[model samples]
Target: MGVKEGSVLPDKNQQESYIDKQFLAAPVKSAVDKFQLIPEFLKVRGLVKQHLDSFNYFVRTEIKKIVRANDLIISRVDQSIYLRYKDVWIGEPSVIMDGVTEKLSPHKCRLSDITYAAPIYVNIEYITGSHVQKTLVAKNNVIIGRMPIMLRSCCCALYGKDEAELARLGECPLDPGGYFVIKGTEKVILIQEQLSKNRIIIDTDKKGCIQASVMSSTEATKSKTVIRMEKEKIYLYLNQFTPKVPIMAVMKAMGMESDQEVVQMVGRDPRYGALLLPSIEECASQNVYTQHQALEFLEKKVKKSPYFSSPLEKEGRALGILRDVFIANIPVRQNNFRAKCIYVAVMLRRMMEAILNKDAMDDKVEDYCNIPKNLYGPQ
Candidate 1:
């Protein structure tokens, strides 16, 4: 019979002598092969000189991106502030050495108690008084600021040097350098791990109740949104809602009108079905079954609180929050009720899974509400 497709066939490249394959024995009692194996307790630490190449590359490339992302604006009264940055560059240090400009050396910085850094310059242009466009500010390069350089990096003075050249600069031949010089001291940048921002994280409390939270942050605003389960009821804590608002009210405001859909979204079985009963019953009792009614309920809640000055302003702000509450880091219509429905469904799924799977309750936690920082030395 022919071999069927999708079957694992034995490889035909095996090559072994009869004596070697049939029996294996050591040539000597304590013999070892030099190229055969390595020990399990051995560790491999990265070379510092090797890391300098990569770190310097990031400083040159990523610094430009960081600067462009946060560009500065200087308004001018005499001339229009039309000048904007085009490109950024790193140049040699302009420190005066016998009335001549020269590149900074790591040894020189170590002896002088100064930093080993280079000048950062930018190419800029703007319109002049004649309404003509694109004029440079200076005859030559324009200096912006200084950037610290890593020792033995691509732009370092000792880079690409031979033994004689390295000795000429007063550096040890065996030294592998990857550090910053400041005030005649060597500083090494350590790695830091942080929690991801602007996303939902589901966790269980000590009582086994599920909590879904998101740290919402933008350039100008930051708020922590939390939805927690307590006493068999789901509540949402958000801005301007002094009393925790019902998650069902939020769902209804997002246009999930049918209680059947909400209950079925949670699950159809008896155990899961019980989780949605209280929320659905509360939604029904409040008479907030339609989108318009839900918006009015939210408006009333916001207006009843003492935060807003007038009814009209409170109503407007409540409406805005009802429409734009569930999204961040992306642009969409302000009142995209469909997106909110999807978000509600996902949150419900997380809670349902946490309730059904007992094993999931003890899963590892990545709750980085506050990070711990360690101090290395006696300082």
Candidate 2:
């Protein structure tokens, strides 16, 4: 075909139009023209701000929660002999020299090849006498242990110090401190990312069976609870239990005796009920038809402890383990397992969904945008 005169010739205006349309350009401004916020952000929250915040939270709040979880210690031999922790606090860093206690600084710890740590003190009330003549003794500022101090944290001596003050203490004034001095060695804890806690994660196991898991974390306990299908039956795997326990049996032990109630709790969908039927039948096959029978069945399955040997004690210990360790993120108050049973049912529902829809199953290795990554300080 013969080319048009303007298209073949490519006039000056057409050439300009072609350039403008094919290659677009915009005015470029220097970074100085765009207000710099990074410097200001650095000044407000330094590079190590996350580490410092985590350490401060650990010291001021987490430590108290940890202490409160194990506040009372009762002797096994003599129940009357017990110790109650009233309060706990971290003391200022100090060292004893020639029987004289002197304040310790991070610089001194580095030079002396010592750890920069503070003493953890607790107030305690205890019974120190016979059961018939028990005497309650209260103690104050009892030293329990030493905790390494994270520099620049709220509990650190240099937390709010100015440049001149930091220089006076032989520290780098420009240092963004979020590390520990351990035996004269500077230790920096890098942030680590892991699967979320107390959230249901549905994935397939090595055996190609759909599973739902939770990394349950509480003040007193941290455990992994998983419910997976095996040969058409659901099973629970927890550290405190034996190899595995039937999911329905676990529910029944948690006061969910009726299989119909368990199915309903999971969902009204027929697909969910179908997936749970095998587990329910498995529980029945084991003769676990009631809460007491379920507990008795689990009593033998729980890891045996030397502390609980008697029949009654064993039964109670088994129930206690289930209540305290199984899906521990859900609180079991006053021996109530209603919430825990519901949580298990939800896990089951998720697993059933994964089975029904392959896309519903979360990949073992997931995208960063789909997961939460949290930075934590040293324990």
Candidate 3:
């Protein structure tokens, strides 16, 4: 209680404080400023969370997929060249130079002005014509080439070291490691912000020209298949179709034999039917009807330097070429022809919707190419 006028009672700050030291837990403090300390802790946390997964994915999955994709083609090439070889498999990754396996360190890399990379080993077996026997190469690991390694990644030598150990190994105590040590240099792979891959990106320019492209990426291939609307006509660059195949021809090629069917597949809407009329008419003018005939027309459009040996060989090549040209991941086990046709139909439907809808044309849609799970356009 205040006893004097203009005089304050004992303030909370002026009050005496006491603690029994024996009962108190050990005090914790650091030399670093609290503000600075927080940011440093956050920096490490951020690095760990924002870690790039590209390297790990590339090694574990992408490398194997690449090998598998090429295995058959390599085998066939060897057979034609009179050399016999089996499938290919990548071996344990290592860093080797001139028949010597070496430890890859960032400091050494920087000093030597060399990239901190590891050899991509490939295990392969071949046969001798005289013996007719499979012979394993002396070295199971054949050096394919060198690939850059990320620092502190599973592959890095310093990965799993304690702080004290890190210092002994010439690492900074405060350095939150997410960078790659290239030839003794601290290098980092910058975090890049990009549109989702393997999806269609749709956007329209100020000129009112609608443009769309699907970045098709499969285990074996990556391609930016583009389609654009110019002069009120849709021009598609789907796998081996010509630069400007009219929309109707593609529809017809995909087993849309009649205008009514094409119109129905697009939608029951009268507007959709009207939008398809020009394409259907143009398709009729080109006379692309049956799949066989449509394929033939596509084959004619493909320009090449070396012609095939025989009609059978040409046709066989055409089959593979056509599939890869317009779409991907079509296995012999499935009804690829039908599936691809349907896929194209759906693609056309979406493209047409984007072309017609004023809002969608102006608004950018990432991953826009794929049909939604609903199998129907927005109401």
Candidate 4:
């Protein structure tokens, strides 16, 4: 007889539940007893599983933070699911449900909840040799000036991906100014911003000068307070003074016969004037007669100029031209070439001294005569 149209089909859910119950009940018939298994399986394994679970949760949370505020669309193909975040697509293990396929629509999905906004500002600073002045202010989204502000010692405020690692190792040199609002920390951010804005303003001034008003503070009756903001021209004065060279050395180097001549020569040369006088005064402190002896010895040393084969030959060739001029009795301009000749004579003396002193040669005349006669005059 044919089945009736209203007859009910066997329940698939009941069959699956029966199979599962049978499998569980039949599991006690194993050849190996449960008590005979390794004890670590119950303790260490359980702890390991728990630790793995915690680690997995941490990783998932961190990944979620990275992908938050971003939509993820996924598609299943074979053994893998192709996941897409914005324009990026990735593949991972996944399962398919029944014969149905679900696709994420770009327009319907919402972004993850992870996102942050950061505000950037400009910092301005005026720096001299010994002092630093700083200011910080907001910046608009436009280039109002063409000139860039001068930063004495400036660098970016942001620490990139490696900053944390570097900090952990105590290798990071970043100034944690704006990141914290503590007493000294607050100033870093404020100063950086101020310097940035000041540069922009300076660029806009057309004269390359910062004309912005800076806030100043003054001591009051009970407390310190901001008095007023005033605009001032920034000035940085560098120390240009240098200590002078010793008088004995100057006399020796110049082949000067007297201290007066050394002073005159130094005064004539601005380079020498800045260094020679002080050095001479210091050297004079050793002994009065020794100072004079040093000068005379230096002068004698200066008279014996050394002649190198290469440079001396070249100089000799040039001097040959001058010697010809002198031989021709041509009135060469003395003042223009006199100082140059004197410098050459001094250098020659120093060169000779360097070589002879190294060899422990006491006789200056003997060594002086050994130099090429063509380059140096007859001994």
Best by lDDT: 2
lDDT of 3 by residue, 45-137 (tens): 655434535555556666677677655422332453232223233333346579787775665676777777766666555443333554533
Query: Between 1 and 3, whose lDDT is larger?
Result: 1
Q: List TM-scores for all candidates, in order.
A: 0.54, 0.87, 0.71, 0.14
Which ten contiguous residues of candidate 4 have the minimum total lDDT?
220-229
Candidate achieving higher TM-score, 3 or 4: 3
Q: What TM-score does structure 1 among the candidates reach?
A: 0.54
- Candidate 3: worst-modelled 10 consecutive residues by lDDT: 370-379
lDDT per residue as tens, model 2, 1-379: 8887677676899888777643335543667734575687788988988887878888889889988998999987787899999999999987767988788899999999998998899999999976678899999999989899988877788988998999999999888888999999999877767777778889887878888999888789899998989999999998888998999888888899888899899999998888888888888889899999998898789886787766656657678888788888898899889988888888888889888888887764665533555655533
User: Considering only N, C-alpha and C atoms within 3 Å, which residue pairs clash in candidate 3?
Assistant: 106-184, 109-183, 109-184, 110-183, 110-184, 239-325, 239-326
Q: Each prediction's Cα RMSD?
A: 10.6, 10.9, 11.3, 36.2
lDDT of 4: 0.29
Error at 32, model 2, angstroms: 14
TM-score of 4: 0.14
lDDT of 3 at 70: 56
- Model 1 score (lDDT): 0.65
Give candidate 2's whole-model lDDT.
0.84
Query: By TM-score, how accurate is candidate 2?
Result: 0.87
lDDT of 4 at 299: 29
- How accurate locally is residue 137 in candidate 2, as Cα lDDT from 0 to 100? 97
Which candidate leads in TM-score?
2
How would you order the candidates by TM-score, starting with the best? 2, 3, 1, 4
Note the residue pairs that clash in candidate 2: none
- Tell me the deviation in Å of residue 76 in model 3: 6.9
Per-residue accuracy of model 1 over 51-98 as CA lDDT, tens digit each:
664666555676566557445454444346556666777776436569
